[model samples]
Target: MKQNIYHQFITKKSSGKKSFAVLIDPDKVNAKSIAELVKLSIEAKVDYFFVGGSLVISHHLDECIQQIKAACSIPIILFPGSPSQVSKYADALLYLSLISGRNPELLIGQHVISAPFVKKSGLEIMPTGYMVIDGGAPTTVSYISNASPIPADKSEIAMCTAMAGEMLGMKLIYMDAGSGARRPITEHMIEKVAQHIDVPLIIGGGIVDPEKAYLNCKAGADIIVVGNAIEKDFSLISEISAAIHSVANVNAG
Candidate 1:
């Protein structure tokens, strides 16, 4: 099993190093595309690969992970949208709890069902508090999870929710605007949530450009995850990665 992943996240946070992760939806990519992505990711020095999607309808999950594993050493973390998404091929799993929603199923029900398999799979578990923020347009996650997102303008609600999740022993806090979001989670919201939580914060969804990725890191996102945009244009991998890493350089200097 891949070890010390949570430690890596904490150590990077303590050192003010920002990470860029490319999110790959199994339903979206194939063996050839995975090979291409892995090659670009290696060139980009991308920090991690987040695998999974809100609604994966294909059997490409294991094949995708195997192809990447065969190609490079970049860590593959499962960002599963359901219990069925768990795979032994990945290095770790984001054991997410939808803390932002009122849906009991997503908050804990899914965890209960996936726990035994996850524990047996030997995947390092990262207990993440998942918060969905309104992104100006409806997303598959919101619709499928049957939960309304926290309003984008409500930073206080986001901050408090993160604090509560941290207090409840969550190792990380992930703020997402959902796939293909019309607007990314705001800098203000990221700052507020970062200030309130000691755990590493991951911001994703609707982050399509290098500038937004860079600004998000500056706003205290320990990790920036990009997906949909990259699916359309794989070249963004290097550009966005450089932008995120530049934050680390600035902090180090």
Candidate 2:
């Protein structure tokens, strides 16, 4: 059997080796594009490929995962937006709970519907506390969940929420600014939240450039996720990966 990828992430965090994940929304990219992305991803040396989207109106999810797996050796983790997004082919699934939201549906309701299928799929499940920070616009996730994002400037709220997630035993805490966000998760928010949580912190959305990716790592994000950025410029996968992984995790010790 293959080693659990979640354990690998924990080990990487403990060793102060930051990681990068390329989010591939199945709804946005086709099989041919995914093949190209996988090749670029291999050259970039990304730690993980996050597969899923906020709303998948097509039947491409399973096909996309299979194609990426065939072309890339790296582990593909399912970052699903809903229960239907689960796939057995992926190495792991981020069993997410919208801990930052007040909506009962996203917090636990959906889990009840998806639990049976997830267990049957035999995919490694990593429970994640998903938090949405305002990225200066309305995002698909925010709209779909019907939950307001925590204000970006309210670092205290982010800190409290993250600490609660850690206490709840969530394996990871994901703070996203939403895909195509106008702004990425701020350094202050990342710093405040990371200080309060023990699990690996994953930040995503609006990370369009290498400099922003580097700053997020320096601010204490253990993993940085870039999606739309890579879609705009395939070469950025390597640039952003290097920029993020190169930063020293000052908080690791």
Candidate 3:
């Protein structure tokens, strides 16, 4: 229901204040179960909810979003893997272009197909340049997207890719190590990209603990996203949320 969602996020994070977000991949949870999790996530002080996945198996994307929206005050953002994963029911959509991959479908072709629907749906669209790094494992996204990830160890290549994306007018730069990644994106990579780009930096995938989240924050990540970890333990949202906010508050004070 909220408009100007991208600006809202930017404004919300001002003054070094951090927020907690939970990524809901519809492929992982059903409507009934997701509602239950939303309630628990709210109790965890999670700042927002992100819904989408590499492959959408759920028949109830809009319905699930509406159900969760009714249960929590947290804003829901769409993190679509393909154009079809989009639903107009959420607050905003992260319009991601996989800069790490040479595949034109993810880069622009898919966006072209989904653009009209997105605009007509009245959802806020935040243009983002998404770069997937080769985590320790071969992720479903990498497999389905059929694109190679930038080497996790190559900071210069990552920086150049991110810079090119920004030059092309992306609002945010997201670096994903892919879901269930054996390792999270390194602090060094985050620091390298953060130093180079002015836009918000979103880092997700394989972040399983608060310490790792703290490391991303320390490396200058503006927003951090976690999904699979919370799926394994609903309580993790609270634990990691508390850790990130505590660190943010400490730094601010």
Q: How well does candidate 1 score on lDDT at residue 107?
A: 94
Give per-residue CA lDDT, model 2, range 80-112, as digits (tens).
999999888899999999999999999899999
lDDT of 1 by residue, 31-106 (tens): 8888899999999999899999988899878988988999999999999999989899999999999999999999
**Pairs of residues at least 3 apart in sequence or in different chains that clash in candidate 1:** none
Residue-pair clashes per candidate: 0, 0, 0
List per-candidate RMSD values in Å.
1.1, 1.9, 1.7
- TM-scores across all candidates? 0.98, 0.96, 0.95
Top candidate on lDDT is 1
User: Which digits, one per residue and each the tens of the lDDT, describe model 3 over residues 1-253?
Assistant: 3347677667755667666678988878877779778888878788778898888886678888988978877889999878887787898889889988988998999888888887787788889999999898999889988999998899999999999999999988989998899988999999999889878888999999999998888787878899999899887888898887776777877
What number of backbone clashes does candidate 2 have, counting pairs of residues 3 or more apart or in separate chains? 0
C-alpha lDDT of candidate 1 relative to the true structure: 0.94
Off by over 4 Å in 3: 1-3
Whole-model Cα lDDT of every candidate shown, in order: 0.94, 0.90, 0.85
lDDT of 3 at 86: 76
TM-score of 1: 0.98
